[model samples]
Target: MGSEIAVRVNGTLPAFSDFGSDNERAGEVESNPAMKVNTSCSLIIHENGKPTKHILVDTGNGVCNSVKQACNDLLAGRCVIDAILLTHSHPDRIDDLSLIVKEFDNVHVYCTQNCWNDVIKKFPDLQSIQHTSVEAGKTFEIDSVRITPVSVQHSNDALGSVAYVIESEGRKIIFGWDVLTFQNPNDPLLKGADLFFIDTFTYNPHPETNHLSVLQAYDLLKIWNPKEAFFINYSGFADFKNAENPYARVPKKPMTSDELAAQVMSDTIPWGYGWNERVKVASHGMVWRSTKQIEFMSPQFSEDMVKLFTEQNYVFSIKKGKKALEVTAETDIKNISYEFIKYDVESEGRRIAATTKGGFLAKPLQMLLEIDDSSDPAIVKIKVGGGTNIKMIDQDVSYQKDIHVKRVHADRLRDFLMKLTS
Candidate 1:
């Protein structure tokens, strides 16, 4: 196995001056472009292994010098940046591109063809750097990681914006910035991500066609259900110090940092709900490492309770929780026309004792299936069955047919109990 993948946040732009302002006191953080240069740029992703590779995303003003200094001080120059990926052609997002090209040799710059043209036209003097054009939906590999671009709506329609999905060793991550909306809701490329960073500019819902509001971001998280999500792209309106009407209903004071020797400024406006545990507001200098573990629920099921019931598997459907579970099965395994009886549940040890009222031709049956809820994201312990109480409807007799299964069903029950707190 190679080393682990790491993503580091270099800076975050301060929110706009009027962000989260009420009829009362207006917020204080200025929306000047000069201040944005200090906050809004840089992500250094180190894909570990024998041949470790470092990839940089976005180059806001001063990012090149900061990252260059970090390489020297942090790793003794062992990890050198190999490539730079642009999210858009906006000046705040690419102010330090020329400096990066001048400082680092043979660094390939990748972006949409439209963004590439915009960059050249805006900065004609900086043509020496190698420019590589990438199209949406196309994928490119660097070391063990595969990256794909998907189109996103933004204020700068002429330059456009693209969100990237990076996959490596069964792990997936997404990076989206300055995004307004997605072209498709069910884009397979955007689903089942392990971790993602998205644009969250305003706390309240906004009718603007450009930036995403906190409410819109919450909707997207409910759909994707990533293991973790971070909100970026702040305006001055994001001032937590003056926030009187927070979207999450709870107010949080500014977070201080020991490294910076100052209060760590935050732009996050959290919204509490079931998915709140998996998402947070982002801060500068934050880092994320990929674990490559399937401990969290996918689009369908994980360790705890099975949350999905698909048409493909019609024989049985399940609804599970911390202390209660419901399993519904069809009377006939092969036919969808017959009436189905719901399984009544009672807990015993690790198993749930389930009994079904006899169907038209079937006799009442009792089944036992084990469930283990000791870990996060738990799994089902055994297949659905309590064959002892089950009898044929026509014969009115009991039988010992096992509800067969192959894996450790307990592994499927990770966090149903914990979800109660969520």
Candidate 2:
């Protein structure tokens, strides 16, 4: 179960400047080289639950002594880091590699060709350090984990960015960030990830050089159907609490802290969406475990009314108010049952009465009753049903003549009456 592991380190880098305190912001000039917060960097370790032969992913802005301490704590004083895997060669992501190499003995660094060149230019003193350049579609083994790099587009000058697909313990995890979008529909390397961490920088479609909006991420989830998905690379403006845009939707899947810990410990979840999806944004350091399942419950409708509408194949319209669901259905008058009571026809031949359903009797029926005739096809109005008053629209009034009933049908009237009360 302990095949892969990751830890968030403490150190301010230029990338993390947004997360720094205001006082700390003033001291940026003299801050430790390792304390730079250029971007978010995470240390990913892959092992077969062994201290030896572990792999570390992205050392981050390696200047913080606290970060080093955190790494030491995670290692538990076992073997030193065996290898370093770089996602990209940005300064914040790679600046700490030299410090890591200087502190540890015989550590091998693995990166893409462009990333390796960038690192070499910055750390000429560590030229003797062992480095291996990799390309897209290449698979490399790190203990029990298999890592495959997939090419992606980025906003960086060196456009050759790559995301990793890590396979271990019979499951696959995809790490996708910095890519503008999933533009390649036929890329086989993008398939079958059990978990995906995608970049969702904005709530709406504010096109940038590289990044995805929350809506784009949701569309990907519907298409990929990953067991779990998380959004990462989020901007402060895109906080969930402030997410009022209709397009920015959260994942429908359930998640828990224990599940997040398991994903992190196994290194089965990537950094972006997976991490963001599981985050609880309340008080700092406050933890909770929710065992109850969270479900999206829709509005409730009366079972009888729903059944009636379904059976009649009626095209109903629904509107939601503050407290209730308002529904309207149109049906043919002949379908209604009129079994009970008799009518007294006057010389003018019109009958008027209130329905048990609480609606006033209207028009064509009124005209026919006045004429004392059953020969005309007239519209009979059931004024109020289910607390909602029904009004005859243009189609209802113009399409037919009215029928006057001296007595209402017991069964049909009972059904209609039940609809009102129920």
Candidate 3:
């Protein structure tokens, strides 16, 4: 058996002069004049038997004062953080980094060149400590753990954002925060892995340039298939508990093409997705874990599959003598509909076969398998109103449906489908 490592959460907020308690200070920090804090900071403790490695992913607003106190109070001063890994240069993520560097003399700070520049530009006082400017596809080792930085698209205009893939004790874990989407769904760097932590900022029809919606994150969960996946970087609009659709948020802006290419480099960056069950409404100190196992519960699909079906506009049709059936539809982003035509066929003997299409068909279908089962051999045909389409296929079929200009579930059906699928 591999080493049993325990992850201790050393999260903290900024220390305000007015607030006497840390909790009160965190509340003030969120609405203060310094910066509009959108997310919290986190510290990960990776211990492999006698050799322990402490990795701090983000230094929240309070300069890590909360983390140091929390660790001392929780772990009785037994935990010694070895290094700091920053996901981005956002104020909420790196405000306390300078304080951390000054306090810990032996700790090595790791971040992208762009993040480094942004930090130095804002806080010139942090120029003294050792800083390693990380590049995409490069791996750095600290004690028994090896960390690889993967570039991610962010809303900033600086160097770029990044996610870390940490390998230790024979296990690989990905820390993906503040990313819009997994750049290339087919990229090898996003293949099989033990665990993944992703952004769950919004749900569907992403609103801004960066950040992942609840629906987008689920779609990624289906593709990456990590043993365990958790959502981070939440917003005030999110309500994890009692949330009918649990994962839903407005989309953000997208990362540039160059940023995407730089982030996904290897074929082994494991995949998984889930909401932040602990902290809802932008609360702090939420965490989740993944169970490292790859099971074929259903067919794993991607954005490419959605595109292929829509681009061809092939409808489902049954041949006089054939066991397989096929259909397709296409549309643009503006006039896109969410209703997907599920292709199903009931053979003369009641053997059922079916598939679905919609604005985001692949992910919904993947989730559908978890709740229901298809029966009978009847070829079902439907159209995915929105522009999204399936990019990949798995099984072989014989019949094809040529659906031309059908618009029954154009609006109501589309809305219903978005709610169900997302």
Q: Each model's TM-score, in the order given?
A: 0.56, 0.49, 0.50
> Could you give candidate 3's per-residue lDDT for residues 236-323 as a string of tens digits?
2322222444443322222111111122211113331232221122223333222222211111133222111211221122211122
lDDT of 1: 0.55
Tens digit of per-residue lDDT, candidate 1, span 143-217: 666888888888655455788888875778888867888778579788788888877655554436367765577
Question: What is candidate 2's CA lDDT for residue 374?
Answer: 42
lDDT of 2 by residue, 1-422 (tens): 35544433233222453232433222432354443433333334546644444455565653434445545544556637677777687665677777778787898987798888877888888779888888878898876778888887766664557777777657766767666655463466566566566665544554553666555665666566565555554443323333455554332122222222232223323445554334211111111111111111111244333212211122232232233333344433212222112122232323322212223653222111122234322223322222111222232332222223223222232333344323
TM-score for candidate 3: 0.50
Positional deviation of 39 in candidate 1, in angstroms? 6.4
Q: Ten consecutive residues with minimal summed lDDT in candidate 1?
A: 256-265
**TM-score preference between candidates 2 and 3, better one:** 3
All candidates in order of lDDT, best leading: 1, 3, 2
Predictions: Cα RMSD each: 16.1, 21.2, 17.9
Off by over 4 Å in 2: 1-14, 17-50, 62-67, 183-188, 237-422
lDDT of each: 0.55, 0.46, 0.46
Q: List where candidate 1 sits over 4 angstroms from the true fold.
A: 14-51, 73-76, 207-209, 236-274, 292-422
Arrange candidates, best TM-score first: 1, 3, 2
TM-score of 1: 0.56
